[model samples]
Target: MTLDARSLIKAYFAEGTLPGLPDGHFIGGRIVANSDGDRLESYDPGNGQAFARFGAGKGEDVSRAVEAAQQGLAAWRDTPPATRCQVLNRAAALIRERSDYFAVVEAVDSGKTLAEARGDARSCIRLFEYYAGIADKLEGRSIPLGSGLTSWTEREPVGITAQIIPWNYPSSTFVRGVAPALAAGCAVVAKPAETTPFTALLLAQWLHEAGVPAGAVNVVTGLGSDAGAPLVRHPSIAHVTFTGSVATGVGVMQAVAPNVTQLTLELGGKSPLVALADCDVDKAVEGALWAIFSNAGQICSAGSRLVVERSIHAEMMEKLVARTRTLKLGHGLKDPDVGAINSRQHLDRIARHVEAARGRGCSILTGGSATHDPASNSGWFFEPTIIDNLAPSDPAIQQEIFGPVLSVQVVDGEEEALAMANATEFALVAGIYTGDIGKALRLARSIDAGQVTINDYWAGGIEVPFGGNRKSGFGREKGIEGIDAYVRTKAITIRH
Candidate 1:
């Protein structure tokens, strides 16, 4: 049976309401509605229709959650690593069993297609499984001291953690930090992005079912100011992991400063994609599309800035435009090539960027307007836009539009291309496409981004460290290095 907008809508409503914080925050292994009775409504971005209403958690709610996490931590800190591994593995199995349902919920909540949502669900399961596999392997070393003295170092949990996940890829992002922290024997008070909290709440339930002790994992849902700020400011929170825009990340840093908290931030990016004349134009085009167009270009590490050698610039642009035109746009459930923007506000922001670019005399090669499917006339949508005749320093190029807008710049040669690609204030992920492997590797080494891909857009796997440099923010997530963020080193010395 095909799942389209109407059918999904019917299924969603037939259940009476969307599945999420039906009562309130998930705290101490139970759902607790806010005492103040504040609430927020969640909408389906594919259409401007309200689907679910949940408690808008406040500072008091966050405080309660933190207290719960502290109590839970006291209990969980003594849990054997082997037991934690077993619980995480069980959670991973449960997530895999209900992957389809979670995917549907994600698609409705975040305005991403079913295909993308399913991929995120799978990634979430993998993260839990990966952390589970590594739980028992968090080994410490013994350092030999002179004479009868003995010394050793051990990795210990950083205590209760405050995990702030972004709206995009909510399920996967939630697990990315939470899994490692749990494996490290730390309890967590997670704040899911206000716009998309359904899957996170559901996951919390699954965690409890998987045998995670009461208060070990909690979800507090509300506006950032109401719930998020207080959670960050809580004195008991020993660590924080945030994923979002740079501006917001700075705010998080400020909030956590008073507590002297350990932090890991995955901020925004204005990544570049460099296509040399010697590269395969077909592969470059494919990579470019996957990098920027996937997820409606809302990705932080999107390859929005396309730097091409002047010789093949015209040919590349032609192919990019032709392929972009063929992309289908519709509600996420319909599985269109492109889906609605996350919200009306975000859709307008994309338009403003395009208009600003046009005002500066940049040429719009194909699309630069809001569009909609006849089936769902109320959704927020934007055309896949390609802007040319813009310099590398153009606002449209320098800033993160966070939409399906690609800025094209032609360069004289390799040096110019490198200079242009590295000119951004943000450095997260960059890509280089060239037939010369030696040249590609050389350029990759010089790129200012944290992760560079050659001939492809996204490099590495779930086990590879992923983060950024400069204004893109600090610290890393994923791989073995990712788990390190949740742990602290303690050296013990004994005199015998």
Candidate 2:
């Protein structure tokens, strides 16, 4: 059931439109038109013009996707582990070969710069390859037994699992969840974020082409209420892996409470980038700039809060502000250093936070307002902003402003800097820049984040486990630890 996906992918990017896009759900190993005739138009974030219309899945469609997954679970779960791993390898190869095509479409679809989108596509490929190695190694342990008794364990799939994705970095996030789930032999019902379903659907199709059984991979796209909620609440779903806002994660928890289904949530964060007095100013400046500005600062683990020691604060601020002002903003297709925000609403959200900071008498060191492309004058764009003032309680410092904005807060010493870093309720990932190994280790251990880095912001990839601490959400994703949520252990014993 291989699709002419290459042609479809090529056609859209070539023409800069989606009229030829598959306007349907990818179910039962192929494209499926919606049960109802309702459709929703997707806009190009670069220009804010409607580019394509896709099917709007309702509750019934969600049921259909679940049913399809249930039908395929047995065969997929029972397949030899080596064969399963091979299929994953093949899928990764396919994506890697067409990586450029994916990059262009991702940039256009998600309003990310071409360079950023390429990194995301590459992340997806590497994640698939990393998970493929673990498929055949899901082994259990033999227990010590006395005399005539023998005991051991077996890891078994948890039937149908639902993976709800987020719009930002959709391609990478989709593979992050699904690759591990599939490697563990679980059939999946995937709900890509409504606005960014293109890459996920195309990736699912490639999985099918790589020998996944029809229905083993399903994607239902539409509004969250219509498709995502129903999929989350679907009683038959054995496990759920969701990535989004904390408020929505709570709703998902309440929905799955009655079923007692297992859940893994990766909620957003207001993560910190702490620079100590001993840290290299150049490295700290570069790390801070990248940690907040990449992906237009839409990443859940973005270093939105910059906590700096008072002694080096002014010097570091001068250097950071100098570089940040030089960043170029334009359409994603143009591969600018910074691209458009995902939507007008998101632009407004970024603006409100900046305006609130100004109202609080914070010094707007650089950008502090929403502006359009200086050339086209169209699209949702926000100037890269840096706000500096007092108070750890400022909303701009405390909240996850998923935009290209950095709140630079000055702290007295190491203790105050670390205190401010952990003051926020959200603890996902944090970065501490310092020259002292002892100090780095101490701060890394003291930070409340699930993962911490010294001198670098994003130092790890698919190899290390990542998640969050406290309100940032929990359950690890990536690495071998990621597959645990998709399977259950069964103990067996024999007595003679």
User: In candidate 2, what residue range of length 10 has the lowest lDDT sum?
Assistant: 1-10
Alpha-carbon runs more than 4 Å astray in model 1: 1-10, 13-21
For 218-273, candidate 2 gives per-residue lDDT tens digits of 99999999999999899999999999999999999999999999999999899999
lDDT of candidate model 1 versus the reference: 0.88
Steric clashes per prediction: 0, 0
Deviating ranges (above 4 Å) for candidate 2:
1-14, 18-20
Return the TM-score for candidate 2, rounded to 2 decimals: 0.97
